[model samples]
Target: MHNPPRILAVDDVAENLEIVFVRLQAHGYEIITAADGEEGLARAREQKPDLILLDIMMPKLDGISVLRELKHDESLGFIPVILLTAKADRADVVAGLDAGADDYLTKPFDQSALVARVRSMLRIKALHDLVQDQAEKLAEQTKELAAFNATLEARVSEQVGEIQRMSRLKRFLSPQIADVVAASGDAQSLLESHRREVTVLFCDLRGFTAFTETAEPEEVMRVLNDYHEALGELIDRYEATLERFAGDGMLILFNDPLPCDKHTERAVRMALDMQATIKAHASVWRKRGHELGFGIGIALGFATLGRIGFSRRFDYSAVGSVTNLASRLCDEAKSGQIIIQTRAFHAVEGLFEARELEPMTLKGFRRPVEAFEILGAMKQEEKSAEA
Candidate 1:
């Protein structure tokens, strides 16, 4: 866009300068004149003009020698150099070119021809500068994009980890159900459904208040973590959803998001496995002078499922008489016992080691409800025996 070419004309003769300077200036070029090769080289280095018209024969460094010096200096090497000479000697022209002069003009050169050559060289230089500027800008943009992509990738990985953590929290549900909820945008959708047949498991630690009083905080934490590890594994193995932890207790749910025909059977199996794990852990705790026990209650019924609370902080939980009844059953259970409602027992009786327990009136219920004790999981042959 800025087309005012800066030209440097070098010659020993004062008369020659007037002719060349006027020709280049009339052509709209900004002109700088030097009387000798030494002064020409000095101006070229300082001003970095678009083109240099160098006179071959001059005092204090010949034109060819000055051209060689400018060509050798890396910073000035790209400036176009044109050799001006009086003699049209073929050897001198060849020598001048080898010294790095871009073009050669004889002393009798026409004013129009000289002006044309200078314009052509300046045009080429302008084009080269434009390309270089574009290349530099492109390189800068590329680096910025690469840095942005790296930041975006890091944020995506963090989001993925958070999703996994939330899914793990939903251990009370089956892994399939947990995956479904995790895949959804929000858990609020879980609450807007009709009553569905689902199994609920309630587990409470026996004498937890006493343990908290007597045991060191770290020791209590260690014991609770040990229990959670064993129980978490079993829940995952059976593909159950862990609804939420209620202090020293855990509530498990099954057959909602991903319905399973054997929901009752799965609930019974989980209860039995939990009971067995406690017994095994109890023995180890007793040997170390520590006491640990658990009580489990299971029920089956239609539950109102949904997420509740503030939009920013909500919980996916079931709300109905059945959930409360299950909690009450856990309180009514004794240490090392698995209590299940009569209806739940009927659903999975053939698949579990069970015994009929006393009928009792549950709080808020109209009448006493029949109940059963789940001894443990029953093998296929054991189910046949019970049948």
Candidate 2:
């Protein structure tokens, strides 16, 4: 429902105000009257009228002053005004117009002319109001679109970061374990310092240092690449976490970051598979005048594990004597031998045939540590027949 346009008429002369109030009201506008400029401005502010008819020579405040005040206030500036004066002087008319009067009449104004002028100003106000409404709606829509785009950008960034983390993790972890770590999304907590009874396996090429010293750089990398590829597949197949690899050696861990039942058996089985695979690779390399053999050490002991290294390079490493024992066992193993720590050997005694070696004094230990050399896995028929 559209409300009628309101008009405010201000004049000290009661007859003039009465004439405008009656005339515009008869023409269907809601009319209000004020006795002087002060009252006019107050009514204009209160009602926010569509048009104002102001008398130029009022006592308290005059038309020009009221017009200037209305135009100065942004809230009231759009309302149109017409100056009513008794004098027909050109100078007086110019002053009123310069002070923002829309139109003026001398002594008296024709009711029809006054009504026509009001209608014209009302049309202009309607157009301005429509533009303002549309601008507000458009601004609101722009804000919504910006918010949606920001959310989309954040989600895209998160997905991209996930893909990158998976790529980096796959380089060191098996695909299944990599998936678990990547999905967890909290590498910090997963890699935090903790202690667990893990099976630690340390292995290296038997004569890698001599080979690297004599062989060309290209030949050395080619041999290392071949050695890594064959054993890497076996490590992943057994779902072992590779702690670190340097040159021709690797430190593999079991029951860490992710846990498994009988981790010692798992580590021993992977070692047996690694020895067999390297045996085949060593045969082919021997034909090319390069001799290489692989040995591994498996131990079951408690070790502190966590992420270690600088920002650019990080290793999920195990620290303490358990890792040292495994490395020392590897150092003692002859070519093609899979040495096992005494504690670890007891876990897999039924699955594989291993000979207990005499206690050997190893570095970083107070007493001689008992060890065993694994020969091979017992055949299924042999296991069943023995059972």
Candidate 3:
């Protein structure tokens, strides 16, 4: 609850002090009486009253002197003072005004006029207090807003840094893998060495070596560029991780770094897509007096995968028998052919038509490896009926 405003009345006559107290106290002001100027100044400083009423003819210090002292002191200077003087002395009234008295009430003053003056001074004091409170609140709100802006700028800077890091990752990793790594904020975990089952695919132009030997350097570069571009698109479409690309040869892996349930089917489909894409370019190459064909090999097995190389250069590669087996099968594949080992053939046997091939002896294998050639995907009606 709010406290009432305090008024200090200072007069040498006990009767005047009693009259001032009765009048202001009845109007709901808390009144403090003083019989002399010295006592009034002490009460004004100690109690810090909202208003002071002083008489001109006092015993100790006069009203004008008290007013000057009150105005001079920083802490007590703002308390409004009203001087009480006789009507005959106009010069004393002028002196009180010059001495920083806020208002005046002459001798034989009306009770209603005194009450009115007190009310006016207290109202002004309330407004000054309210303005001070609002100023303090505004300052606090400004500080909070500055802090919020600082936090927002920091978050924006962090996101920009993440985007730049993802852009650099795109140069090495596929778009899907790059996004996953950036979102998870844990590239080291993905790059750590681990062994897992994956489908490895290898592809290259069948006669790229001979073409490179006979064709001009610029022509060879153009053909290689076209071949890599087509294969790169299919690899991205299948969401496969590209391990490495050397000359016209490329290696891709699925179900590692990112898992895919239909990895075997994806690899076979991508290989067929490569053949169909090359067929369009084949006619153009033939018209230019050059012939080119594409072949692919797929194998499924567990392999150790991780980042491998020096600080300046590196690659995410797979190392195991599966990688070697895929390379050997790719080397043995003829033009427009896709060769797969027995394991991969079983995974997608129902989804595609494949012809079983005789067991063939391959490097690094003690026994001959069973293989098959995938013809094409089954028709939608056949797949749906089977399902």
Candidate 4:
């Protein structure tokens, strides 16, 4: 429901107040009457009328004085004021206008002219209120936009920090493991010492030590770089965690930071891929009068794994019998061959074709370790039938 506009009429004569009340009320305006300037000022403050019809020559506090006071007050300054005076003298009119009177009416007022003046002032008041309301809303919207921008900046900073942390982790860990750590939002937990069953793969070139002894330093470095690059691509493709790479030797782990159901099979496939990739490089090395061959050894067992080194430098590594066993097997393997311990062999027995080798004594083991030589991955049909 909309409320009608309120008008405050100030006059000393009872007849004038009655006439204004009847005229404005007939036009759907709520009229409030005041007997004097002081009463008018009090009512104007209390009622907060939209317009004031103030008369000159009031007994206490004249119309001009009331106009001056209202214009000075912050709360009532914006309300429209029409000076109603019987004096037709131009000096009196100028005084009222100078005192902030918005409009004026002289002597006996015509009912039509009075209503028109009231309507005009009411329209002006409505426009002022609308402009004020819009200004407030715009201020609120500006504050909300500022808050949203602040939140967006904070989120962007947090994401950038996470990306930097992930990049640093990828330097020492595999891309797959680095992503896992970043998504979990907890790198410290992964670095904590723990034991879990993991497949360990150790690979290196045969006769690399001898080649390095006689080859130029630059030639040796070029060969090592080429060898590492080829093997590095295969490691990333299989999502294996690279533990370390020293010259021609490299160590990889599977199913530790990121769990894989077919860890042994993945290791075997990666080894075969590595062999195929190195074969091309080997041809080039031989043409250059260099002899080089690749060998790999794989084993599966529970081992303690954690970050090793100071804060400035660190590595994710595993330590247990499994690691030692894999290293010993790689040492015993001939060129172009993949060796597997009994445990790894049993895990992927049907997935790959392997030949059983006689139990051999290995370093750090009291008994001979049963081992097998992996020939290659079986065909899809053979693997399906075995499954």
Compose the digit string of candidate 1's lDDT tens values, residues 1-387. 235878889999999999988887887888899999889989998888888899999999899899989989988647788889999999999999998888988988988889888878887878877887898898899898899999989998978876765654464455556666667755445545557778888998888888889989988888888888888888887788777885679888878656777988888887888888888987887786687789998898988876556745656678787787788788888999989998888897677777887787778888887888888777878767767
Q: How accurate locally is residue 29 in candidate 3, as Cα lDDT from 0 to 100?
A: 84
Off by over 4 Å in 1: 1-107, 110-130, 133-176, 184-188, 191-194, 382-387
The 0-to-1 C-alpha lDDT of every candidate, in the order given, reads 0.81, 0.87, 0.86, 0.90
- Tell me how far the alpha carbon of residue 35 in candidate 4 is from the true structure, in angstroms, after superposition: 3.2
Ranking by lDDT: 4, 2, 3, 1
**Candidate achieving the largest TM-score:** 4
Between candidates 1 and 4, name the one with more favorable TM-score: 4
- Kindly list the per-residue Cα lDDT of model 3 for residues 152-261, writing each as its tens digit: 88988988978877765665567887788778878778877999999999988878888888999999999988887887878877888888889988889988786779
Query: Backbone clash tally for model 4?
Result: 0
Q: Alpha-carbon error at 257 in model 4, in Å?
A: 1.2
Error of 3 at 3 (Å): 11
Worst 10 residues of 3 by lDDT: 165-174
Q: What are the root-mean-square deviations of the candidates from the true structure over C-alphas?
A: 11.4, 4.8, 6.1, 4.5
Query: What is the TM-score of each predicted model, taking all chains together?
Result: 0.63, 0.73, 0.65, 0.75
Those runs of model 4 whose alpha carbons end farther than 4 Å from true positions after fitting are 1-4, 18-30, 60-65, 68-77, 88-100, 103-124, 165-188, 206-233, 246-248, 280-292, 308-315, 356-370, 378-387
